[model samples]
Target: MHLFDKEKIYGDRLLAVDDRDRNVTYDQLDSFSGELYRKVGGKKLIFILCENTIESLSGYLGCLKTGIVPLMLDSHIHPSLLNGLIREYHPAFLYIPKTCIEKIEDSEVIWQFGGYCLCERNEKMPPALYCELSLLLTTSGSTGSPKLVRQSSWNIDANGKSIACYLEIDANERPITTLPMNYTYGLSVFNSHVLMGCTLLLTTYGVLEPDFWGFARKKRATSLAGVPYTYQILKRIGFMDMDLPDLKTMTQAGGKMPPRLHKEFALYAKRTNRKLIVMYGQTEATARMGYLPADKTLEKCGSMGIAIPGGRFWLENEQGNEIIEPDIPGELVYQGKNVTLGYACCKDDLIKQDEWKGVLHTGDIASRDSEGYYYITGRKKRFIKVSGSRVNLDEVERLLKEQYEGIDFACVGTDDNLTIFMDQLILDGGEEIIEYLYQVTGIGNRTAAVKCVDQIPKNESGKTLYKELETTADNRIQSK
Candidate 1:
């Protein structure tokens, strides 16, 4: 059940095709990964700066095959964040692009794969990587947070199999890259496709990019997966009208898509004889937990649907008691092999055992219907999905203060936009602050808004009353 084991049975078949249409066969991937394995495989822990390229995939497969725990990161990560991660984890090796190696000094280049360089860390201490630890990913979207989701090889395999089963992915499917390789949703696509011997089309172009659609058309891509934000872009680009004849399956996750958009796409799928699957997941669950079946899309338009095959979802009240009655909002609880070991905030936390114990207390407020379909009401966590990436409002506020001193601001959001409510609005500084917010959170400016306020609504305990801010956001959106 290894992700790449199908290569043995499908050696000559196309496993991946890059934007250039340079197809890589299963045998080619095997041989390339073998070379990478021999070069950088022995490291106890390696930091892989990843892009959606053939070499990045090879390095990832190589690390997994050789038992090297790889902390996959975005290739274009901020230098300060990368430095913070390096200082915290002290990985034994750094697999980075050749152009980016200059930022990392005191390292010897041991191997090169195309444009990527694998360098051994200098003065490296042997990482205390747990026996079960296979991957470390930031729970927050690529915000350079030290907090990470700890996953075992079993977690990846189980989740991939479940996703493949529900999505009906097979060797004939061709899934094009729509998100960053560092993102869990994107990685899940890679894992599921690889496990099923499917041809994965790799591209760096984004969903809004014309080149991306052109490549999809050329490759005759059969399936596509995206976060809610991606669907927003699809709607903006008039995706339903596009002539993608080979597209049979479309998946949405990461955050709740607007009910209107959900119905829009579902109707489009129905008209075109396609499937639009709305899924629910988090990084802590190794990418997926629930998915709404195509047949139930219109009937249960906004529901997250039932748990995926091999997974179970229930609800628990604030007192940790089970909630079984329909329409009762409670925290969504999931139990599955895909549930991660635990979170890691620093290096010492890596050796922590499976603290989650196969049960993930997903900090989401949801309700189940009579038919067992779950619908998200809100989030318990102080995170917002901006363009498919989780942006922690608290973290954003902290960074905003650091970026601009004495500016009291509170970050709040509706599903589609992040509004920065500032107490002291600096003249002509709105766009600048918005730009900084985008830089820090990876949320685009289109979804970021700034509003001047007399005061930030706060409770007596000095806590910014986010509920008040949310009301303001709702009013603002309604006015627009």
Candidate 2:
């Protein structure tokens, strides 16, 4: 079913609360969206520079209603990058803010929507899009790669339904916006809540900002979603001490949270009679594959839990054979209807059908317990050979986390050494941790060093920018 199809039934229900604290009803959304649909309908491809604003979201929903495929992109993207994408994709129309309009001044303005402008290209359109292709989203990075994950209407519907089912979302639930809508996880929150007639609380303020919690409290938001990095910031700001009586559930994803942090939040949720749900997925699978039940948080502390409804998880060996033995680590795999059509590198790739079938090889190293719960250990590509022994960098980082409670560490391996970067200078036992790593791994102490920085570089979702760390490591090796 279409996402907006429910608006007819919930016409007068409040659909969303904007950053300015303005409430928008379903009737208002439908009427405004109808106006937008008429102005930009029948476009083959539309590029939307999206923010968490009602206007952007309404325009997006309108595109869906009119069967216009939209490529949702971060509004804060650089002008050079936007130009590069436009040159590569040749989208028929661009819906962007008026402030960004000057950057693409060569394009002709087709329509105006208050603070935004819709620009059109007079040149030849890109190749014909596949019949089922509905949306295009960039992979989670700022590398300016033309690569985008192609998703179908089925993918969106299945994922949204599964999320709503497990989260028990309904019309009364208000989920606060904790991430950018361009990101798959963040976008899924919007999709599922909107589908269920739930209210969306929108804001651009981060966890560190006082306005974020203020808005959440003012709106009486029932749910809050965040990446591991968001939780880290929450913990730093003493989230446990905050009086959030109305908050009913908290969800986390994006990356593996340290086990300690997981337990800490689980205990808090248990004590406060709330739920702290942990979920797992990638953009390729349309945002969710598995979710850890809140009731089992203490029992399955670090587990990624079982697959979500309508999805199944298994492990595969290097030979592509299924791993039946429990507690044995292997590459995690998922089979679900939410799997995307495939990746698109250029405009021509949009015409291709589903290449993944119904399966995805999630390149994560994980082990399933006897109860069928999955626990991600590390990534396949994030490993290196040190002293003729293979060592997963994430494993080393996990070890460091276990040893040091509150410190942030990123491990990267060079040709001759494995370096651990810390976000703060530890006055006590930093050397001891290095010695411990050398002792445990048998890698020489001389081959390992610890460097301190003010903070670790991370994207909006709290994912470590390992490429940046690799670059720093390479430069340090070169300079030495």
Candidate 3:
């Protein structure tokens, strides 16, 4: 099934709402989308550069109906980066919000939807669904440079189905989203709700502000989703104080949450009658693969739960052999329809989809307990073996989060050394945390010593990129 297939199934139902502006009904969505489908019915690619508002969403939904592959570019991106992406993706046509029109002068047609100019209406967009890709997203290039990942129409449908099935979403469920438009986490909320015919409320403009809670309560949201960074901020600001009723489930993903924070939040959610769903996923896997059950909260402190419906997982050794033993660290392999259509190493090439052997190598290291519960030991990149004893920096990061106050951190290792990534103001806290790390693991006995720094590099999903951090240090010292 395709993105449009969901709309066709739930057509004339409430597809979306824009309470901040005027309410948009299903008939309105159908009329506007049909009009858009009529207009851009032949472009191989259509670039949309709009903000996280109603217009952007309408254009996004319209892309589904048109079967014109939507290539999304963040409105806040640098002009040079935007130009680079445009040249690389080479979208035959472009749509920009009126606020961003003047930034592009060389495009073939800069049709301004949502208050922008009508640059071109010439290209014919195709209407085939099965073979088409729904949206093209890139890894947050903050890791160095962005690489494009193509998600087929089926991949999105499967992701929505998996999320809804695991979350136990029903027609009465309402999900609130504060995630940005260009990110997978945000897209999942929109896609899943659309598929389930559930109402999705949007009030992320000034998140963490006092007003957001008022809106949350007013919306009577049964579900909320956030990243580790988002949850960190919420905990800092006191999420428990809001005490939302009618909240059925809240999900955490993007990066691992600190164990202490995980426990506290789980407890807090219990008190507030919310189920904190700790989930594991990447953009490549369509959004999620594993999610912990609410009842299993705190019982399996660091586990990321088991695979969702329509998916299977297993741990594989270095030689790519699946291991059946419990608690054996190996690469996480996912097999399912939700896996991505491969990723491009660069902006110019499209990497075709293929399961290595059969399952996708998730680049994460994990092990299952005797009870069949899975736990992430660390990222494959975060492991530093010093004299045969493998050191998982995620363990260090978790310890730091517990020991240090008001600081979330990353731990990276290279050349037989480990460095802590904390904010500039938290250097002293990092030093204290490192002292505790040495006490816990006796790192001094290992091949290398621990170091602390003002900042540790991370990707858009808040994932620590140890490889880039190591290279960044190398380049800085070499240039000096």
Best candidate per lDDT, number? 2
- lDDT rank order: 2, 1, 3
lDDT of 1 by residue, 1-480 (tens): 377666689888887889976777878877876776677645488899998888788778777766789998988777888888888888888899998886785689988878899898774565588888998888655567799999999999999999999999888999998877778888999999889888889998887789999999999999898876577668888898999989999999877766777899999999999999999998899999999999999999989999999999999998999998999988999999999999999899988989988999899888999999999876677777776766667567767755775456778776667888877745664777766666766666678777766677742113366656655442232112
- Candidate number achieving the greatest TM-score relative to the actual structure: 2
Candidate ranking (TM-score, best to worst): 2, 3, 1
User: Model 2 over residues 65-170: C-alpha lDDT tens digits?
Assistant: 6678898888888889888988888888888888888677468887886678888776486658998988888985655679999999899999999999999988
Query: In terms of lDDT, which candidate is stronger, 1 or 2?
Result: 2
lDDT over C-alpha atoms for residue 358 of model 3 = 25
Instruction: Kindly indicate the candidate among 2 and 3 with the higher TM-score.
Output: 2
Better of 1 and 2 by TM-score: 2
Point out where model 1 deviates above 4 Å.
41-43, 382-480
TM-score of each: 0.81, 0.95, 0.87
Write the residue-wise lDDT of candidate 3 on 1-480 in tens digits. Answer: 444554555666665544463445555677877767666655356767756666777777777666667767676667777767655545566677776766665655434454544345243432232244667777763322458667877788889888888888877887776777777887888887777777667664555687667767877878878887778778778777767878778889887777777898899878877789999888888788899999898798778999988889999999989999998989998898888777664434442544332257888888899988888877787778655678887877777677765765666666466665554443243345545766888765234333334556665455666666544432121000
The pairs that clash in candidate 1 are none
* Candidate 2 minimal-lDDT segment of 10 residues: 471-480
lDDT of each: 0.82, 0.85, 0.69
